[model samples]
Target: MFNRLRCGSGLIQETVPRFGFGPGQENLFVHKFTFSTSKRLDRDKSLIYNSQNKPLPRLDPSVVGTGNRKRAQPVIQPSEKFNYSVRKALELIYYEEESRIPTLFPAGLKLSRYLKSRTLPLEIDLVSRAVLYNTRQSKLEKIHLQRWAPVDFDKNCAFSYLVARTPAEYAVLVTIFREISRLEPNFKPRTLFDHGSGLCTGYWAANTVFGKLTEMFCVDPSTDMNDLATNIIQQGVQNVPLPKGINFRLKAPKTISLKYDLCLSAYTLMEVKGSLERLDIVHSLWERLEEGGCMVLVEQGTNAGFQIISEARDFLLRLCEADERDGIVDNEKKGEVLAPCPHNHPCPRYHHDTVPCNFSVKYSLFDIPYFSTEDVHNDLFSYIVIKKGRREGFRFPRLVEEPLKTKNNFYCRLCTGSGMLQEVMCNKKHKDLFHLSKFLHWGDEMPVHLEYTDGKEKPRPVIDRSERSMSSGEHFRDSKKEKDFKEEKDSKEEKDSKEEKDSKEEKDSIVKNGI
Candidate 1:
């Protein structure tokens, strides 16, 4: 469902000056380097895990399609802690090297210092103004306009890029990976392909979400990026020396010839120059999918990202529909959306009044090893998950945002049944439904049935457990069982006492009468 506020705006984990430039996985901006270790930036302004107070929109019973599909998906969340020894060591090394280089090697330090001083907001404005106003959009016309490049591709820059983006990028990847794992439990891909691997965020996501990827083929045009990915991943996982199972291709092939169980293109389509050109990339990526294979496309969560996801969704659906219409696939469904959509209808966000779908999750540097500040950008992303072959499974409607609460109701924004974002409200009267809403966090599949209505969705939400997996009803049931047992035992004891008293009275009367 579209939140008007969200419709206007929102993810790049990249800080200031690191723009997505070049081709392949190079579209994701390089991560910024920082020297400070503060967890909160402007602590008073930033909310620490604001999600706690975050209000989700409501789900109206009247608007909802009815059924009890509300069976919850198994809880999938990232572990609270993971091994970060490698990162910690690297950070210390960088700090020491950074301090020594400025004094001994004066020239490079000037460039580093200048880059470090840049902020994200300032860069965005400068780039937009230059592209839109100064260049008269000429830069945009050329397809790959150079916004700005801070430094040459080198080991140090690459290391800093990956480290700086790690916290935010990991959060984004974890969410996508978790959902993918849930969607395809039986899907254990023997081979994987990563397009625009960008320090292999896809690999990290895949490894975390699904324990072992049989083999990984990572392709990115930048040699520096490929090296950085190999070094960082191997160091973190102790797979140093570039394991035989993982291959990093530093050059872009004229075409992608390899087929794999899973393929990923993360935040790279924007570099393709033209809309149709980007679609060509999408088509090529789709062609590489083996039967029953899956493809995941990701983009930054800004308006541009959402727009691209919308456009891509349209193209993929059209391709599937055309395949079906042309009888090309021998009477099988050619493709289907796996996540963030319950149905394969045209994107609801494409409509002018509707907002594009995106997912948001929070993270902090404190959660990981050797970072300057606790503050990190929240993970907001517009993504699409597609599978090659048709599957028989439940595609639950996703909760679009945090559900909103009110005095009498909760308005839940959900994307379901062909990608329609609708608001459904559940009042205090619907105890079970309302209880389920509390268990829901952002980006969850509503475990219940939701219907489409012709009426205008009521805007008023006029609305989790504290990490416990138990639902509200489960607690009630547990208490009810205890109550029922006590009542049954008390009734049995009362009956036994009455019988004993009656028998005693009868015996006494008989003895007194001397019958």
Candidate 2:
């Protein structure tokens, strides 16, 4: 017989009463209990058994490994060398707004006014005037006046330029030099020759990129500029001394006997009076380049600046052609365009009137009183790098415009190796290429192969390889050669027509005779 029994949560117990027959007699009872294990213990045992027996579901190989993933291509950026040097130089020179406020204020104002004048649109009167001659013949004559004059950099102007323009110039130069280094990693220049080296910005940029040079020759016509450059190199104190193997001259060397591994002429062409003078300067700089050396030319990014750079590019190319023709330079040592262009052909945008082939670099501005309040600014510049040796290796198309990204695709405007501008579209279907293209920016090289999506390639421009010459303030072709060429072509055409007519007449006679 069983009495009432109860079980607790952790343990189970049971009690039984004996002898229910006795009416008022108390019965003895026995209880039995046992401890129970928790459910967590059972779960741990099952997990261990399952883990040892069952294998993990095979992971999708593609999602489980990093080896199959594509790494991002690094973007080319402007170096901070110039910015760092500028801040350091300013510190070394003890540049303070409060100390030189009086001197800098007027100079800054003058410089601003001068720069504004330079940027003003140049106007020329083309109205013709009729003049009566004694011989009763009236002739129409047009008078043209010069609209702008070059700024003469005095001590104050030089100082102003150093404070305001040097950082931007240095940024542009460093960008260019870094590009060269990227393209030609083995290139190391021992000597540098910088013409019109305002404040020695080229020197500083080159030194930063290539490290210490064996010799640096800086030529500037402005004595004030030269002094300012030397003072800066001396760190604002005469006792500090100039850097080793660096020399500043008020004028370029008269002879080209001494050549340099690198030659630079930045913003100097715009200062010259005429195209011929700029050409002369470019020629001189080209001559100063050693064999297998590189020459860099830079100017403002304005249309005029672009024209100046284009002219220099063309002139240098022409020189290379002439040298090759005359057997002055070997095929391996001939000059070639190194940057911003994939071909030696004429520039694609050269004929375009409104558009100029220019590039911009972002740079930080130094803190100067009465100057720009912005910390960062863009320097728009037109430049060309010419190497004395033939360009080697694969040529990649350059991105001329900023890449436009859409939800599923991106567009790029590229200056191709065929010397043509092309717009290309890359979509998600391209997979990795589309992802890589997103990192590309303006003035960067597109590594992917380009093809016409419509299956029709654009025609290349036809440039006449005629014997051209630069003349007095103009570019001209020899009239005799043009006349002879035209005559020869006309004669060939006439002869071909006559022969065809004779053959047709013969056929007609034979038909009549047969009839």
Using lDDT as the measure, which candidate wins? 2
lDDT of residue 294 for candidate 1: 84
Model 1 worst lDDT window (10 residues) = 38-47
TM-score of each: 0.62, 0.65
| Total backbone collisions, model 2 | 0
Q: In model 1, which regions exceed 4 Å deviation? A: 1-85, 88-157, 236-241, 254-257, 366-377, 451-515
Q: Over the stretch 254-288, how does candidate 2's per-residue lDDT look in tens digits? A: 89999899999998877776677788889999888
- Model 1, 238: alpha-carbon shift in Å? 12
3-73, model 1: which lDDT tens digit per residue? Answer: 22222354212211111122243113212332111111211111111111222333454534434434332
How much RMSD separates candidate 2 from the native structure?
A: 35.5
TM-score of 2: 0.65
- Candidate 2 yields a Cα-based lDDT of 0.67
Per-model C-alpha lDDT, please? 0.60, 0.67
